[model samples]
Target chain A: MSEEKKRKKILEVKDLDITFETTAGNVHAIRGVNIDLYQGETVAIVGESGSGKSVTMRAAMGILAKNAVVNKGEIIYRYCDNIGGIDYNPEYDENAVWKEADILKMDKKWIRKHINGRRIAMVFQDPMTSLDPTMTIGKQIMEGMIWHYKIDKQDAYNRAVGLLKEVGIEDAEKRMKQYPHQLSGGMRQRVVIAIALSCNPDLLICDEPTTALDVNIQAKILELIKKVQKERDIAVIYITHDLGVVAKVADYVNVMYAGKIVEVGNINEIFYDPRHPYTWGLLSAMPDLGTDDERLYTIPGSPPNLLHEKEGDAFAPRNAYALEIDDKLDPPMFEITDTHSAATWLLDPRAPKVEMPKELKLRIERMKKEAQANGSEL
Target chain B: MAANYNAEPLLEVKGLKQYFTVSKTFMVKAVDDVSFKVYPGETYGLVGESGSGKSTIGRSIIRLYDPTAGTITFNGMDISGKMSRQTQKDLRVMMQMVFQDPMASLNPRKKIKDIIGEALDIHNVCKSAAERDEKVEAILTKVGLAKEHADRYPHQFSGGQRQRVGIARALILNPKLIIADECISALDVSIQAQVVNLMKDIQEELGTAYLFIAHDLSMVKYISDRIGVLHLGHLLETGTTDEIFNNPVHPYTKSLLSAIPIPNPELEKNRIALNYDYKTSGIDYTKGTEHLIDGTHYVKCTDEEYAKWTK
Candidate 1:
């Protein structure tokens, strides 16, 4: 795992603040967000709707709507010259110094030519909307390569077939002749993934890619993404609300609330030793296969309305372990370890140490025991 | 809860089949020969993925789509299709459906009071305008909404609030059975728990049975008394919640259970997903029969496979 620390940073989002200008008021969607994605690693941003998970990723990809306002932030993307080359050292380059482009600062035309769908690609939540119903699967897949690389139709078709096979589609040749409606939901999502990977991108952003799929299909998609990530050695950012999906795929987890990340840590640290009360609530709310409880441990209230300016910590109202200071002032992120940090009043030196819910503690213990029994790394 | 098990079932669906003809050449058997019973005041969960015919069963039972072949007995009365006007009205009051998309189900032009009170008006349940208003207010509060919400439109509410309005519309007439077709799946995880708890509370207070159809197995295990697993329009397993969770007999049931993503990092890292192949398993569905494993558990398998599974 020491090699993980040596991984180079591919994208860095610093102090991001985004707002949407609505008819009623300006909705502050993202609040001082900070995140870094390392090459060949998977980072998951977990949150409910209106928590700004999608907005952050959309901002990174330069796809924010016209109504959106980037109040203050920089989305710096590092371009590695030796990607898809032999013996690639992501850390440093002696010959061609890596070029860093601020996606927020670049115009739409510049980003389209230099970054979007070539250096960075995105897979949306719904494949029905992302894909064109009129076009055949073969044409749709080949269109990206033909546009970006100026490749011939024959070569693009060959690569498209190879991509379909790589994504585990049976009868790749026959499937290419069909339209989007001819495929199943799972199959459509796989085609979308294939299209995203057609350009050999350096970063892949999946926004709830598997939410529309069944459980069995979801498992297959997650496995396919992991396999492709390793083979391509590209950075991945998964934006989803399902903690279960986060547990299975993410190397690091960021727990978002209202509009800010309340906790950020490695997967094991966030799941086993969570610091924020919001994280605890999220973990307890999910019903596990072994759970026999009468009632789910639901978070007390709904998410805050972003139309108005927030006073303190946005999650303080629903947090059962909230301190008085939480309502008075927002807490800065307190570092627990080099890889773990949380923005909660409970982490303050002056605040009393609060224990997690009994149910979560017991669940964590059982999970640790199961992991040890299976001889698996968490 | 156990005492209610001895009572008559609120809804009984037997040999239900709904088929849609796509073109002149072929037909799609969306639901085929499915059967289940929902006891009074008990939640009977129907679990399956898309194209598994779970949603078709829900729509068929509520008479939105006529069943090709089957008998639907609600309150010990056959109301499958082409019911008389009076019989239709009576059945409509006794059974209500909450759709998956709240935005599409409720009308934009209609106010919340009119939407909730439409059934009352149609059935002539309320004699006066004041009584209708009172009933609407009562149901709005029952679903954790205020009376002022009745004057607003459905677009004014959030997704969770719109779902509450949908529940209020369903509960306004005190239906004996509610067919909730993926009602909470559209909401967030936190709001989903709230809605599930609300459904449980409403069941306790009003004794309303539910045909809860969803793909999430964990939520089904929590709220359901009995569960029916569907795969390719076949009811492969039916058992009590504990029986189904602890001792799933069918290979399809095992695969479905194993496919669920558990929300624990350490446990999920070691989780093994079981894949079931129909062609490789060599279990023919034509000769498949439902065998009783224990008091309340049943598994669909052939004679030889049933013996092997039981052994």
Candidate 2:
């Protein structure tokens, strides 16, 4: 479905640039990222660590590290509620007219009051670190509702218990009384999700929420997120490195590499007819359960240094299909279809043809066998 | 059958148990009467969760942690009982270990050459310093690292490169069995493929055995010939990789297999979620140590549902 035709766009991040002032040098962590999230769709921004996916979402929630500075970008939010607590001029509110605020330039106090946890809630990867050891699970869930919504005590308790049940937690009333240590890692994550969903925010950003969880627990957490998104109709931006998780959860995928998104497409487009060489490598590298390849294919070379501020494509050094032009100038994103595009020199019409690795060809063939066995394909 | 009985496995464990006293008196049986065998030129995968004691098994087998009870037999030699300092040093060369955290396992100040050569020096395997250096270079190349990288410190390399150095250090001693305890868990998925492939190639080249311990079921199935599942210090199931994935006898193993997210989007969306009760499924591992007899597999275990799941 087209994002615009939906009721409203909750968040629109345009041309975002993020840099970190480090001891070594100024690291350009995010370079010109643009994203749009409709009311309820789950858009997963996926890549390996240091891919700037987390930085982009952290910018949206106004939660960046001390050294981070946004060089350029506008994070615009259109909300029925004044999440930022700014003086609402009734005349300023119109159809699709987002409150265009330079998130980088916004005051810390204003952003804290309006943006964070009030309208945009986040659930991080590690629950042990994220959760306060001193507090009970019930208090943690109630704390957000009381702070943001200012609801009554008994009502907050009721909502907290209800949320626990909503996320498929058994014995919600009893679970609410327990401390963080009493619960397993999976249950602790569910409690964290309950806290994030308690606010009923416009956007829910999950940064590798299940990376610390086991496979079964990871599946359960992903299912919980999907359920919450469906019921609350909140826009979700799932940040993760696992493509398997992305394929299961994301409706649209943005492949990031070294602070820049090299490809963006529908799930099927990216998986089936990928245009970028990096995307091809990533797809092939995934260990197919059904495949019989003697050796698994690996993408050679490491992620580039973000601190160096490379002039060309950051992935050019590692990309096997890199052209002469790729080494000198950054390739513009080429439009493959109405909904799909990739930033690669090889996609240029003038560039010579280079087929995907032979192992990848075999992987696709094996994937076809799986499709036939499963009786479905994109 | 005679071939299976007569042939000597590269590594064997009989009733291996490691119990830690969590409180003043209450001891937590982290690994209780777990036993398995690793055949030569084969990969045996150990799968478990955080408290499952999979890593404890890996450590105890390589003598990193002293086991409370049970016997560890390496190449028909019982190395379980207390050994002399010299015999222990000699055993270290036969069995090497690769830890999960490459950055922490490797010393940041030391060069790659010194890290690999230290084992050679400790075992007195090398004729001289030059011979040790040459062996380190050869193993570095074998593990896909450049010969020049031997001079660089750990801080200069990436996570994947550091893991390669770790592999090289383990392989330089010409160890018969390498225990990789969650070796690729900390790496990126794309880079993880490279490390796994490197391990497979090295094993094929040297005819070395591997005891691969990981929580990732799919990767275990991909790399291992035989697989063992551990839950709460109990070895619940053991079989071939294909049998474990396709026809899991135990409910826990079945649930674990079903839990792995399929790459296909449609299948993943349509797959039915398995709901196994964690609280009831957990055995009273604290008590019943006397009744728990070690056999080919966990039989008449306290977790009856898990034991009966196969029946």
Candidate 3:
């Protein structure tokens, strides 16, 4: 990765904590989540259900459920209108962000005006919920630009068409005129993408955008996101449980387990040299087409109850390779490589040496074969 | 692992066609001319995307949805056409279904005892209310739920527990076959495996066949003996689970199999993104002889294309 290509930090989240006040108990959804978003880089937050990957991003976007409360975190955002071919560079002023506003502390009403959609846009998991069923795709796409940027109707329409084309939606004019219901699942997603990019927001947060889509449609949507990210050079936060999706589009990966990031590294490091046991369990459970394993492995037990306050490593009970120290004390993320870090006892010098699963070793061999076949570096 | 050709089929669907009348003139061919068989104690997997009528087939076989045409033979008895009241009662006791949403499938107002007991009551299995309660408790215990849980509501239980309740409800009838329509798709992955294992264990103990319908081909391969792929209201292909995945024939099946997001990062990056061309259409089913079919596999394509495949 070149330094020049190394994008400036567009958004920075620090020590984020969120809890949902439910009748059963307070559910600690996210804890001490720290993440950085560089301009034009796609950072994928991957995890299983209730792993708080979605909640973490939801907190950043100020869309957490009403029962939820953000106890700590500062989502520092720096926006430039130069994203969509507009030359509105403010000379990259460092103090400009603090001077302009505080997203975490600011009133949501104010945030909606200056921050939401205008500077930072989001595409949620289900397009049916995010998109208006009553309105035409064209109107919905143009509505954001008209409301936020005060852009003219024709220009907004043109921009919407451009976005539709950019997302690989053919016959933009016809697709725009059609209603959301008329479009297929894949097409509807593309329309949502168009709507998200209507204002040319600097940061695009896609929360499981392809989960509802079929596999074929999912591939197209992933490609569309990558295409848009590269073209617009906008920072992206891809939140999903599907690791395959993350691998295709994400430059970096964050593995979330029980409301905390168990591992964070570049895609290669996270996949090939994953240090966390939880990450290893996840990797091992996935069914390989090439593998001859009769039984598909599973991570034993369920995720920890969010209502119950966790004592040490949240994944310790489920992790087969968990050390005694893991249950007694929370392991800090040890630095493995410069770009790699994992929260696991395996990285601890004092911890007992445990080998990876035999299934994983076999999978690694297949992966190497596939890499060789594709003529690509693993 | 080819399907055991000589073995006696436990459940055979012949010329199954489920078409819903849209208004008066038009009919939505949700499931058109589909047929398949599940041998005794075999796990037959039905795999398809949404709108492929996978769930409809499961529902139809279990008598939850009446087929517009076709005959369903269970244990060599045809039960597809309009059934007599007594026959319907017997069918209800013989076959059961587990829906995708455990929350929705279970009755909200009814207690767990009443929910599981209803089937026994319908069948007149118990002589008295006390006997019914005892039976329900035994079934509850069999599915890994405590007998005390019989007093609780559906909302009181977690998703996995509720699914277990659904399983218990289906199993209490001692049905010959259970249609689990994406039953575990709504569950967490780890919980999904547990539920799957429980289903397998129950199958071994009770000798009940299963029509496991799901979108997850990988999981289907894990549980199913034979697999059938459905696409756009047509049965594209059918084969043994290993043969289906390892040596897929239909382009759609191959594409669908490849589309599954394998968790391996290296494989994922190299996965060929599927692109289908639905526009270059084939098939004139409207102009065809419009006769019912006896085969499990049906392909909606041009006659030439069909003939080529047959060759």
Could you say which candidate leads in lDDT? 1
lDDT of 2 by residue, A1-378 (tens): 454563566688888998999999999999988887777788889788888888898888787999998888888877665433322332355643345555566788877766777678899999988899899899999998788767789999998999999988899999888899999999999988898887777788999999899887888899888878877667889998888888788888899998888999988777767788888988888877876567877778778889897878899888877878887899888999987999998888998987877776766666656766888844
Candidate with top DockQ is 1
Q: Supply candidate 3's per-residue lDDT for B147.
A: 94
Ten residues in sequence with the least summed lDDT for candidate 1 chain A: A83-92
Q: Rank the candidates by DockQ, best first.
A: 1, 2, 3
* Worst 10 contiguous positions by lDDT, candidate 2 chain A: A82-91
**Tens-place lDDT digits, model 2, residues B1-311:** 01132468878898899988888979988898887889887889999878899999998888877899999998877788888776676688878889899999999889999998888887788898888888998998898888999899999999999999999888988888899999999999988888998899888888788999999987887788888888888887777777666666666777887888877665666576686665776645443222222233332234554345545
For model 3, the stretches where C-alpha displacement exceeds 4 angstroms are A1-4, A81-102, B1-5, B128-134, B281-303, B306-311
User: Each model's TM-score, in the order given?
Assistant: 0.96, 0.90, 0.91
Candidate 1 lDDT over residue span A1-378, tens digit each: 355467878899999999999999899999999999988889999999989999999898888999999999899999866543323454455676688989999999988876778778999889999999999999999998888877789999999999999999999999999999999998999999999999888899999999988898898888889889989888999999999899988999998887898899999999889989999999889887766788988998799898877688888888788788888899999999999999998888889978999999998888777777777665
Candidate 1 wrong stretches, greater than 4 Å? A1-5, A82-96, A376-378, B1-3
Compared with the true structure, what per-residue lDDT tens digits does model 3 show for residues B1-311?
23345678879997799999988889899988887889877799998888889988888887777889988988766788888787777787888888899999888999999998998877778999999999899999889889999999999998889999999999998998888989998887667877887887787788788999988877888788888888767776777777677666456776786677766566566466665554443434333222211233434445555555445
Residue A56 of model 2 has an lDDT of 91
Worst 10 residues of 3 chain B by lDDT: B287-296
Better model by lDDT: candidate 2 vs candidate 3:
2
